[model samples]
Target: MPAIAYYPPLPLNAGISAILCAGFLFLAFRKLLRDKKRGKATLSITLAAVFAVATAGLVVGSYQQYVVMNTWSYDFRLEVQPNETVRESLIVPIPGESSLLAALHLIAGTANWSFIETIHGRGLYFQFNGSAGLDALFSEFAPGGAYHNTTLTMMNSTAQPGPLTVWIFYSGGGGVTVHFASGGMVMPQSESIAPGWRLHQLLFPPVA
Candidate 1:
């Protein structure tokens, strides 16, 4: 039901685009049939075909994006490596874990986040789609230690990008969540999430 309420519904948007495409095609057909003027008929036909193809392409593109990031969330991972030093400080533009989360965030609309912070230094766990991807993302500590591997997840439900864009600060520790939801399970504004979530949050935290 929640997912259903989400804007830019696949079927509806695609249907509308398809109709426009078909309308252009029909108009072109009528012109072609009414007066067999090569120049005019050719123009109409070309336009109609372009509109139809474009609309259909939109449907296909939207569907593909939906399928890939339907119920998705962005994630970042910071490895609290040995010596309390954060690794991967210098993130390149290459396709790393962050890249995946960045892409997912843009596709899901920029804002509408539910921040869940866990003060516990417990090992990080995650789930991608249905399978457990990042089981635990914590390095061994010499016993008592602070939260070296912390996750800052910015989750949102109303992320609808105009054409799928780029936002790096999205939520997820388990990877991009692409599963549909039946409501409930979202974190409150003031609460913290724990245990296992197939989401990841990664970015160089401000070092002291």
Candidate 2:
């Protein structure tokens, strides 16, 4: 699948602009109160109002960006081979923002697996080894779709011998759930997901 560029959070300059506007607003208000001339007082009041509005707008935008950066959630289930048993289930607490690379790194770290990045054509994948070797491909959220998804396939090896299937489901509250299972297992329905919840994907070297 083609990787789509993810939207970035509001820049730090936005927050800085908010702080500066707030300072200007305070100064304008002080000037308005201290000035004795009616004309100068009117000008100071106008400047204060403009600065107040600008500060409010920037502060709101910055708060929204902060929320988006910290609130994304992820869930992963690793099904053991031989009988498709769910051996390990983990709810990854993504500290700040949601990045496929970060999530994969957390998973690998928790499982004590070697996380290797493999570049295939124009795409990137994760090849990790635990009890068995596996290749994981995380897909960008579908256009106009509510959820992001990933697929993990077992690599052919002496222990596993063949590829296994993995399925993903997204919950309404902006959480991603990944289920690893055999090909014959039935896929589960997606949970409710919030509309327009943007999840960021970390693509190396960037993608257009």
Candidate 3:
């Protein structure tokens, strides 16, 4: 597992970096106007450039981390029925804390499955099959870039009874509260689709 990162808030570091960059630039201008020697003015300008680069690095790195951490929680419900009177079921939970790569590997290992990846336009899809009896589909928008939404489906087979239904939940801070259905009831949809996914696609569509 990759170590979780800890850093000061991006806005806070950005504010400080901007202040330092501006201060250095102001000093460079003052030195150029009042001092006869060019060396002091050149040094101040160099420091300003260094801070400017640092500020840009901070913004870019923070945005990347934000995208990775912005994921959803999934509850996979698998159901198998051998006869009209007998039913068997299994449930797997994939928390938001796990990276998408890790989650895929985990599921494959648990079910003895293999998968193939495909890219269509802006979407990435993974089709998985088990040696004994299982088949699944996984998909996400913009795999490594900004995350929007993900969907998974598993079909039932004779060896493993299933039409696995996955319920997705989105929340801020990666914390989710899942409600399980009981007594032959179905889980309610949080929405027709994830709100964040819809908003992101609307605001930042791929350029032609």
Candidate 4:
């Protein structure tokens, strides 16, 4: 429904856009020359336009991938205290769904790391880790700022235990704390102590 964005502010994105645009224009001119030189059927300008748009898409996608690789890191864990079982999922969001979700959650120049969905249901607990690195830059949302920190669909989700506590730790050294908007819950944050930041010990009840 909305238009696709080619982020031209970031050097990485801008460079790709410039190159793709140049290539597309070059192709158009070349096609024009061929049409004149051969004196054959008129060249299809429509096809040339489509090819240019496709090239732009490819360039944008590739640049997105490069951004994700150097930006975010995630560590997800599910611990069952009663059963003494723990499951871990560590993911580095590439330029795909995960990274896209992270991009959606980005708070511009403010927060770096953010959690998408942390819910307890069907006797299982789920949590996800998403973050923007210091080097990560933010472009204005395609539509407007109305969607800032606001999401239409959940980014990432996982499940483990119902009566579980979700702990999210963010990188970047400082006296950081997890500030909850739904409720005024604050968890002391840290960069790295000998033990690292202890997120919180939340207790959840099993779903009926």
Candidate 5:
């Protein structure tokens, strides 16, 4: 998958912007009231419009922080032995060695996720469709806890095998869902992500 920018939630940024705009508008209004000059109404309305736009931006930003942040862990290991295909080893981990898939089924059918989308220091991409996929979307330090030192490794058990390039995407939420649900996940740039996720034959690539 190509890299995507990660825009984590930030309520404080919005709040601060709003407070600043309000304060500025208040000052402008006070100045206008004290001035013997003309055009007081025009200046006040201009400041009010600025305040309104700032307030709207703050609200939307806050809402996005609430959504698009739900995520969790699917812990499972793959042992790509000699003469083995890579796709079949798609195993996600479970909590407490518990049945993570089983729990997912309880939440919804067929957990929606992309195939190893862009990998990052935090985790790989996985998005749910409808309600089922939503069940698997956990937040930072989610229920299962965050996966650290997460790396994709490849080994050339044989000298004759050809190398492979696996593309990863930051999958979650379709276009419509993303547009409606407070924007979407902040995916890092593809360049930033490629080096992090790329696993050369038998080794992890260096981080860019």
Candidate 6:
């Protein structure tokens, strides 16, 4: 099984990793001391090595979470009718300890969007945190460019990728228009969005 990731980095993940590392190391050390007292050098060394690896894993995991929380930036292309434009790179100051999901919520605020799954758009977008049951419809794909607007197709099908569209009508109070990527055809759909960027069900369901 793959190593579990800590979502909502910082205190949650950091704390968990810390505890795991601490508790495991403590056990490993006790075993080593006891074995050493008995002149069991081989077993003691093995336990020590395992303990080292565990500590390293925790350190790496904590760093990954930190990168996502603070440095991650999500660039969403808003698609609106007609020829009007709105700010694209959404960078709202949220807590560094917040998860990517929380960051997305902050940027989107209370704006509601609609998503339509196309006939061939039956794939799923695998997420970094790896929550099996999470819907790809609302999950982000990849980044496109510097603004990093690519999409990673995470479909659970063996068939070739199809098309998808999202019609986002921002209605928090006034009107918010976006650069729509019709059919959910985000650039580099085979790639992944940079850390920090989030993808929800920004697509309006296709109507018959």
Best by lDDT: 3
What TM-score, over all chains together, does every model reach?
A: 0.33, 0.31, 0.37, 0.25, 0.33, 0.26
Query: In candidate 5, where is summed lDDT lowest over 10 consecutive residues?
Result: 174-183
Using TM-score as the measure, the top candidate is 3
- Of the candidates numbered 1 and 2, which has the greater TM-score value? 1
RMSD of 4: 16.6
The list of candidate 3 runs beyond 4 A from truth reads 1-8, 73-208
lDDT of 3 by residue, 1-208 (tens): 9999866587568778888999999999998888855798889899999999989987887777666565333322222212222221222223222233233433221233233221211221212122112222233444455452333322111223433444322222222222322212234531223212121111112358
lDDT tens digits, residue span 114-155, model 1:
212232211222212222112112223222333232222233
Give the distance in Å from residue 66's predicted Cα in candidate 3 to where it truly belongs.
2.9
Candidate 6's residue-wise lDDT over 1-208, tens digit each? 9999846644464456556556655665676677544345455455656655765776677677655545534333332221223322222111122222232321222233222233323221221111111111123322332333244333323433444322111212222223323233343322222223333233344558
* Residue 111 C-alpha lDDT in model 5: 34
- Residue-level lDDT of model 2, residues 1-208, one tens digit each, is 9999754444455555556666655666666677645666566556656756766776688777666555543433332112222233221111112344344433332233333222211122222222222222333333344343343322212334332322221112222233332212322432322222222121122245
Which segments of candidate 4 are over 4 A away from where they belong?
Answer: 1-44, 76-78, 81-208
Give each model's whole-structure lDDT.
Answer: 0.35, 0.36, 0.41, 0.34, 0.37, 0.35
Write the residue-wise lDDT of candidate 5 on 97-177 in tens digits: 222323322233233333332222222233332322223322344544455433332222244545432333222212111
> Which ranges in model 6 have alpha carbons more than 4 Å from their true place?
1-39, 72-74, 78-208
Clashing pairs in 4: 125-161, 126-158
Model 2: worst 10 consecutive residues (lDDT sum) = 119-128
Model 3 steric clash pairs: 79-161, 80-161
